[model samples]
Target: HMSFVAHSGTSAVGTKVDVHRSPTACNIPVVARRNHQSCSIVPALRYCIRNERSPKAPSARPAQDVTTSLAENLRALGADPQVILDHPDLRAADAELLTSSLSALSDWVPRRSLGALLERHPPLLTAPLGAWADFLASFGFQRLAIQELFLNSPDVITSSSVYRAGQVFLFLRQLGLRNEEIVGPIFRWRALLVEEADYQSAASFLASEGGVPDELLPRVASTYPGLLAAPVEGELRPRLQFLKGLGPEASRLLRGFLWEDWCGWIHGLANWSTAVAPKLVALEDLLPGGRPAAEALLREVPEALKCPPESRLVPNLRLLTGRMGIQGESLFVLLCGAPAILSLPPEQLESRWVFLLEAANGSKADLLAYPPYLLASLSKVTGPRFFYITLRGLTSRFMNRAFNGGDAVASESGRRGREVGAGFGIAGSNEYNLDLRWLCEGSDDEWLKRMALEQRAGPGGGGWSAAPLALVVGMAGEARTASHGQEGAKELAGQQQPQWQEAGLVKEELLLLRGDYDEVLSEWDSLLGWCCDKAFTERGCKRFEEQLSLFYLLIQGRM
Candidate 1:
């Protein structure tokens, strides 16, 4: 029971800790109390990364007399003092290495932060951390980063080796990943950096023995980092073999998910047999095509099974069947057409459904016809473009294209068969089968340009004509007239030629042809931009055309 306190006084040593005595010393290594306060290690010390910068070097032996002094230091910083004192590794730790590790760790974080972390994981003290810091530094991490790395993954530190970390780093580098790309995944999944499994060997085996393509090697290493920890002989190989037995497509699909969505969860599965096969069964049970269809769906788009069938797939099917009246083979068709839709939030699916119902004028046929609509950004892309065309009474362009067997066959219904008459142009021809995908495929500006181009190429006529722009202006005049009687028509009398440059509408006047809109480009120029503006949309009482008509009248001479 030989217990002692470092002779604490201003003159005694490295840190001037006050001294006194009490019985609350750590259970294993008796800790002494000073002035009725439990002796905690010195709190603030110069924080630095090892070899980043060092304090005046001292003997590896702690400046304090008792080994308990080191314990006090750890306890003060927030480590569970008794855990360190009780650890067998501490007893075996070489004096030189342990001292060096502690000093490096000390410079790594603020006093209290380091203490809080060590309390959660005391065995971190048992590992040779100095070498770990050195390897991490080789990756160009700063002191703050090294500290966070330690705090984030004490489990890795407890069992990891510098050599193991290097092997993992080398694997990624060999895959052509830059150091930055390697650091991001390793930082996010710290265990990947230190686990002793031959991840490089596993990757090589996957590329050679398992048939994974070499070009995909970099992304596989960078994205599904934890896969590196899967044991080459027992775990990785066996699970991979089982997955291969299911079929090559099956293996490729789930393995792709190990990087995309549900990444961490999939890698943690015991084996595809115990964890994934059950989901496959459930997916088949829920889908109309059964197992083959479900497998085929995943083959076409590997991301479909990223979420469990019961959680994501079943609900999406219910939305289609219960909400949208999609029955039998149609449900499978929708999933296959756009496999990613299954993973969308139920609310998002509902929104696109609701939006589509309105855009197609209460029709859900397009719901099954193009499942990608379900994956579109309801607020940003689909909503803006659909409303842009619809508000102008131009949705007729995409409303009805008869199916030629399976492909779209253009029909005349889009024109309402209403001849251009005096205001709207393109009197007669017949190609109104507008594929909705064209609206969402491009950026906002691109979408606008596509709309402009389509309008320039007459709606039914299918050749260049400026009639649609004049039709848009005429349509605006019509909405206003419908709402405001003869007064709306009176507003059109005051219109003047608009300065196209000031309105931000870029196009040569030649694009207009002979039309009513040739006189006022500003009104429709701001019109498309206005459609995307929430503030503008909310403020106007009428459709965009009506508002543009009103704007044209109100701003008569300004443009």
Candidate 2:
């Protein structure tokens, strides 16, 4: 009999085995006991015995035992044994234990929502309270919470840095906290108080009732008087005067609010001065009497001037200038100094400001011509008689109508006139007339004479002229030699002279006439190449060639 045994060492009796005898014969044994056998079983028994004696064999176990065995196998493989047991497909108890263990280690906790926390720690709520407040703000707390905190913790609100203050202001604005509501917090914290006798009792009652002080009420009402009935001038003015009496620091704070409110009111008015003139005058009265306050008010003038119609700017300018006195130079400077204002139409200009065309040195002609340009030139004229003389010369050029008309018409003239006009026109524009022949020859002659004198007088006479002349002569000689050989070669080869070379020569002559020797030499090289080309007339070429040689010798003698 051949048998398979369970690893638990249980029955080989229930084992089933296959037996093979020869090629044609086979038998299967459903074994009940270990003893019964047949001939075919004998060979199979030997085979099974050999396999069992060898290292490999199949083992059997019950289904429950098999799963337990698999679980153990998985545990040995570093897998969670309970993972298999708790698997949805596994209807097993082992996996529940594994899940429970993991849950225990994770230590999950539940959190109270923001609404519940605020309900518990009510005092914690406030605007402008740094990082914690920012975090709370994200949760959208009620406005009452913000107001309550702001009222109780005024130091917390005011002591905040600028960034924090800005954020708090933005938050309060978003919450629709009115100026009255803001004043309630301020007065509650002693940031403000009523100046009047009965007003203190009224303010105490108002504070208890969570309202703005009665005296503050009138002032606020006056500032935004359109919200109320007819202006309570006498009653409100004193309170405003009291707020203004608060020292510079308090004044600064008051001004920030007043200015903002005033600007808002002004912006809403169709005509600011007509609608808010009294308010503006009141604001002026409220401002501190000093240079600092004057500067503050003056700073606003430019923005007021910007894009205002002539009708509006004129009155504003008058009002500012009259009140600010000499310190109001800003308004005058902007009105007179800005380039854009100068471009305004004559009617607008006349309507906006008085145009005073005053001439420097009592010259009416200078005032009438290029007044703005002249004024600009005069401003740059510093401590010197020479500057005034230069200005006079410049003014004279500008005042001359003939020169201007000639300049304007020169380009439109006939060819001969164009050439003459171009020359004279350039000279006139540059404020100097140049003689081309005189410049070319006269400079060379002067230089040669100076060189001859220097050589005779020795090095003590100054050898500075020699270096510059030597450079010029060497450059000129190079040009001449280059021209001669190149022209002959081009003639021998039957090539045409280059157009650019001709242009260069003309440019050289112009530069030489202008006494620009460096530029002249640069262009002369090109001219020499053109003259050397055989395609050009020999006589013309010889003339230029001779001039170059003579010029070179003259320069060399100077050196």
Candidate 3:
């Protein structure tokens, strides 16, 4: 039912190794092997030599005998038989020239890695050694340094296209790294030496758009070598324009967007602009600070460009506005303070909203003053540990009623609120008080310690409640009452009088209130198990146990 196989390939040291495949059942899909003969220099040479000696006469001799004859002929040419055996290409090569070439290169490359160098760059055998040595010397590399560079990157000495290599060297010099400075970067990424028009285009664009001076271009290229490969029109220009539109601050941030593959960059940028940008612009009105504040949002958090707007940003906003009933300028104020809330996946945002609205019975205004609540992982930190302090009865003294008209009004309100609290608004000594900024950004240990301190301080505002249980009952009644026009909200509001004690409900009922738990749970379980099982069996190695362990951890969280 199962079998193991070995595949052969030449390794880094020029040694042949067999890589084994895992055992699997007959039902498993099998890759078709290609039918092709491998080229052998020894056999080909023997055929040529025998045919030349006797055109029509038949000559029957064993393959070993032919190999012995070939070895004897190469030995007569004053070449090392072992070197020829190691570098098989030398069998058909100019044997006399190969001997001189190896001796010339003996001082530069080590005896052990010489075979590796020749194997990687066999063209070096035919190419003039004098030209390569002269090229290295012309570049001002000392004999010792040349040996080191060749050892590190053998391609510097053995490149077939010396003209192309020279073009790359000239390009880097133009970038501003002169003499010895170019050696480090060139040796690290040999691809930088390959002359391409795109490298010039990218450098020109950065100088023009980024205001990078001509002499300073090398600094940027050395810091981010990938820019040398970016497509001028498709990738470099579009990303620059996108960042520039944000404002001066955001435009300045563009310099930090390190160079990566131009193709991937364009694909991601196009996806973000077409899908994510519209949602960000749409949410601008939701920010309490309005236009100026919205511009600042992009400047502060450029990573929002990578998130899927429809899947992540939209769903998170919906949970706050649609489900939690936090509407208008209040939502804007909340998001402006902590933009990272938008980065959380929609489902994670939904779970946190469920905790805040239902379990805590938190007011919409409280969320505005403290937005970090949105970023908290509900099932992990908020639900199990921090739930008691934020329960229904707690009065949110930290909540600030600042949004009167717009920016000026909110600014004045914040100033007055800070004065009233005596520098104790969010991060105040109050048991429930937490600086949204600190709580959201801090490590897990810090968050846990803060939560533990809050627990020790005793309940501050109010007592516990199970009001989250009422969301299901409220949804059903509200759907029916929607037939009425303006009265629909009034009907829904009047029906929301039931508290945790007033309405008896169980934990299981509350969880299944909004969605079909059975279908969601089953689908998630099947998908995870299938993926993990496939990875584990296909790898068939003890090294993959960590991946299997991580799958178990995720599976536990879902359940």
Candidate 4:
């Protein structure tokens, strides 16, 4: 019983790698088939070539030799005989030319991958794949890498595309890097191969608008190969101009962030200047302290302008102010400390706020005192880490990473919080005593050293509870009563409740307490010694929801 095989994906756009089948698909009761194919290592394409000859016109209809081959090959591939007969071009295609094309492809691709590729892109059988293998190999692409590259972008193999791809490579080879050394990046980015990518113009832009010295142009291109394909007027110019406007350190962010992140950061609509400038200007009026304060905020945190301020940024800020009385300088400090707040959706922002208050047992004072705690991710960092701490009692393991830090910054945040709290007529020292940067910035051991000092200072109202899931997704009232009148609930509320204690709990109570988490855990279990990972995708989420439905029903006392 058991076997493994590689499967090809249908599309070239999002399907980066080939997928495979599982035993569950064959032996177990048929459920549903998976459509997304993004495996790490799967076979992709195959082809071979004979001696070069002048390209010949196709003879109408399949001759006897080609005809027998088509029927046998299609059948052997487990495809319908009618598929080839139905295609106008395939029906009329010459056997000699088809053989030559597949042969050329075989020099780079293997048989299975070639068959899979041909299934998805039948045009490859008739097109000019014969011309590309040598040219690409001259750039140092071996058989396997070439097959994967074609899978990454199959259209590059068609007729008349070679001249453009060649021009691009030659232009970039001036970077003084060996063809073999740059080959991997070329395949990954492939901007040079794109029809619209003007390598010369992008080179010129780096020299001119990009302030790249003529001496360093090659270095810049090698570092950011995709820069050759980026839309100059739309993406490149607006981002460069925006950074230059924000002062020196801010401008270096494009280089500081990872290449993919840098690209995503600069991505904007066409006519970015006309589209984005007015929005940020108008945003000044919508925020508190009006135009002057807004301009100052923009200067300090220019990345706030990454999004359309009106869409998510202002609405999220207003939600904070309207819901919890955060405005004026306090609002200013919150944004300055974590401008990424502008990018988070209003709904997710509210959920995180609730999770901090009810689940983490934090308060509005914590938000004011420690804006940095909100800087890290929620689902990836805060939510999972909070659960990990509560389940493991590793409070020392919890760390906060916020933006914009220094000793001066820490003292300034505390000073600002105190001033703002005094302005709002709230007690500042009792709750806001711990400095945000000092608490979050130091190493884990340094953070540990601060513990006795923190205890001597008294309760900062900064600890969280396993406040019911409703605190995260439902009303405060639902979180209120769900914990009481239920036996053993009080014990689990504390850190790292003992495992032996679980034996006494009623099954219904256990389900109510840990159903959602168990669902995720079960979804990932290994079967038959093979680790089967289900991605946290849409369907995976639906499965989690369905599994937890009974838990919710029991919580409502429906059964």
**Top candidate by TM-score:** 4
lDDT of 4 by residue, 245-312 (tens): 65555544423331123333232322344434555665465555555455445555555555566776
lDDT of 2 by residue, 62-166 (tens): 556666765664455444555445544345333323233222211211122222322232222221133223322222333444445443443443343223222
Q: Taking the candidates one at a time, how many backbone clashes does each contain?
A: 7, 4, 5, 14
Listed in order, each prediction's TM-score against the native is 0.36, 0.18, 0.36, 0.42
| Model 4 lDDT-worst window of ten | 526-535
Q: Residue 333 in model 3: shift from native, Å? A: 20
- Displacement of residue 150 (Cα, Å) in model 3 is 3.5
Q: Of the candidates numbered 2 and 3, which has the greater TM-score value?
A: 3
Q: Which of the two candidates, 1 or 4, achieves a greater lDDT against the reference?
A: 1
Residues 1-559 of candidate 3: C-alpha lDDT, one tens digit per residue? 2122323233232212111222222111111221123232111111000110113333465655655664564455444556555665555664445545655666566666666665565545654454445454445445666666565655544543334444455567656775556543234335554444467777787777756667667766675566666677876676656555655443233332322333223222323446445665757656544444554555446656556677777777777677767655455445555567777766566645543543344445445545666766554444423322233112232221121112333353354334422342422111222223332434443333333333333445133222221222324443555656576768765765323213444334444421332343344344332332233232332544554455345433221
Best by lDDT: 1
Q: Which stretches of candidate 3 lie over 4 Å from their true place?
A: 1-92, 118-130, 143-145, 148-160, 168-189, 195-199, 218-230, 238-300, 303-373, 376-559
Model 4 stretches with alpha carbons more than 4 Å out: 1-65, 74-92, 174-189, 251-255, 258-559
Where does the lowest 10-residue lDDT sum fall in candidate 1?
A: 22-31
CA lDDT, every prediction? Answer: 0.51, 0.30, 0.46, 0.48
